[model samples]
Target: PMYFFLANFSFLEICYASTTLPRMLMNLGTQRRRISLVACATQMCFVLMFGVAECLLLAVMAYDRYVAICNPLNYPLVMNHRVCIQLVTGSWTTGIPFLIEYTYQIFSLSFCGSNQINHFFCDVFPILKLACGDTFVNEMLAYMVAVLFGMVPFLLILGSYSKLISIILKLPSVTSQAKAFSTCSSHLMVVILFFGSAIITYLRPNTRHSEGTGKVLSLFYTILTPMFNPMIYSLRN
Candidate 1:
């Protein structure tokens, strides 16, 4: 059920990325690059919510897998019904706090002059580029987001996978080792595809890049990663 739920979460992520990218591509292709304030705000909200949700859910899934694979006898005892509901509820609950900060920070931004954003979606960095007034608060908020959403979850996933791999290596038989890894291979692959692209594309401290190249690469995690998830996980598994 948690697998399906988290997969559902990723499915929503795919849709969210799809919604913004096409219109952005159309604009970048034909130069119809004008977007309204309302649309930008809405885009900001949806992208932030879904993107953060994906990160949160993936971390949750990793931890769930940790409990199941590394400590099977205790799995049912530990991750019971109440705990599962709390995990899901906590995801949504922790996710909404960003909305309050976004509303205050983004709504207050003055877009008086150039309104052109040079990215596919209204991600914090690209969207902030179009703000008219001082975006110090927005940038600080974005930095906080980078630390909390991007770095922290990544650390959690890494730690979980580390424990998982350690447990797998302890298995006595070669076949058992392979089988242990096989259960998580799908998730491990998904994590690599998503985070690898993200780290390469956006996690850079210096953001200089060429035209269309960055946009194309940005879709790897957002669009292509989700598409690959079911195929790699389900078909292979």
Candidate 2:
């Protein structure tokens, strides 16, 4: 089950990185930083789709760890092949409806003024800043989506790890506790890097000063985190 979850996660990291990096590299190489409105919207849709999936999938991974560590005797039965597939499927599909709607809402807005996006990619806040009319509804919707997709899964990961830590501490032998901790430490590190940067990027107020900071933070989760995930997980081997 652990490998199953890891395999899905590794694939997700690939898809996630592909959504932004290829375009980013193309723009960098050609020095043509412009993207068509349709293309930008398409990129945003895929980014949100994979981003939300990654959040949910991380929580699912955390739950898998919880079952393995805290319910070792029944781990195989609890995380059987069918159940694992269901969990992964749910994680990937759960946010599609909300994200599609969210992307449509943002792109449907009347964008005017500079037209140049402030960030490297078509992120929510940067795109919202370009809209001509009132964006209260869009801003509110972004917050709602952030809370629903970002915070909810983040809290689940925290809860799972909290319970897992308690259980590990209560184990009889130091070696057992160490082994248990080793299984999840890589995941814990990833959760922190991914969610911490993501929450900061999404939940914070959109301001002129923060745009630069937001881009930097976006690089962490979108680029650096994905780049580091394989190294982080491989070390566990």
Candidate 3:
């Protein structure tokens, strides 16, 4: 069950990474930063979908680990194939409405200003900057979405880890403690890497002073995290 979840996550990371990074690279190489409105909207849609799915999936994965580690006796029945399918389906489906709404909000804005996006892709902040109209509502909506998808999942992960570590610590054997730590270390690293970057990018106060930092953090979460996820999992195994 754990391996199954990991496989799905690995695949998701690849798809998520592929959604933006390839087009970004192409745009950079060609030095053609001009992307059609439809194309840019489409890219943002996929990126948002995959990114939200990943957030939910990571939380689910953490719950799976908690079940496996903290309740080994019931793990098999609790995380059976049907349940696994449901969880995966839920993860994939949870972001659809959000994606549609966010895309609509972004595309509906009047981009009367410069068309050139500063970043490699049509990310929310960069695209938001191009809008000539007051973007307070959109910015608020984006922050709400970020809190829903980003902070909530992070709290879930932290909660699960807290319970898991507490349970592991109660065990008498040092070997058992080490084993538990080994099992969770990679996931913990990933959670930190992902949430750290995401929180920095999305949850931080929107100000001109932080634009450069936001872009760097966005690149880390969108590009670097996905690229390294498979490597992290492989190394752990």
The best candidate by lDDT is 2
RMSD of every candidate to native, in Å, equals 2.6, 0.8, 1.0
11 Cα displacement, candidate 3 (Å): 1.3
The Cα RMSD of model 3 versus the native structure comes to: 1.0
Can you write out model 3's per-residue Cα lDDT over 1-237, one digit (the tens) per residue?
Answer: 788888899888888888788888887799766778998898888888888898999999999999989999999999999999999999989989877888998899887768888776778888999999999988898898899988999999999999998999999999999998899989888988998998888888888888888878888889999888878888999
Q: Model 3, residue 73: displacement in angstroms?
A: 0.5
Itemize residue pairs with steric clashes in candidate 2.
Answer: none
CA lDDT, every model vs. true structure? 0.73, 0.93, 0.88
Please provide TM-scores, in order, for all candidate models, with all chains considered together: 0.86, 0.98, 0.97
lDDT of 3 at 115: 85
Given candidate 3, what's the lDDT at residue 117? 82
> What is the C-alpha lDDT profile of model 2 across 1-237, one tens digit per residue?
889989999999999999899999999999999998888998999899999999999999999999999998999999999999999999999989988888988888886688888898998899999899999998998898899999999999999999999999999999999999999999999999999999999999788998899999999999999999999999888
Clashing pairs in model 3, backbone N/Cα/C closer than 3 A? none
TM-score of 1: 0.86
Off by over 4 Å in 1: 21-32, 200-202, 206-214
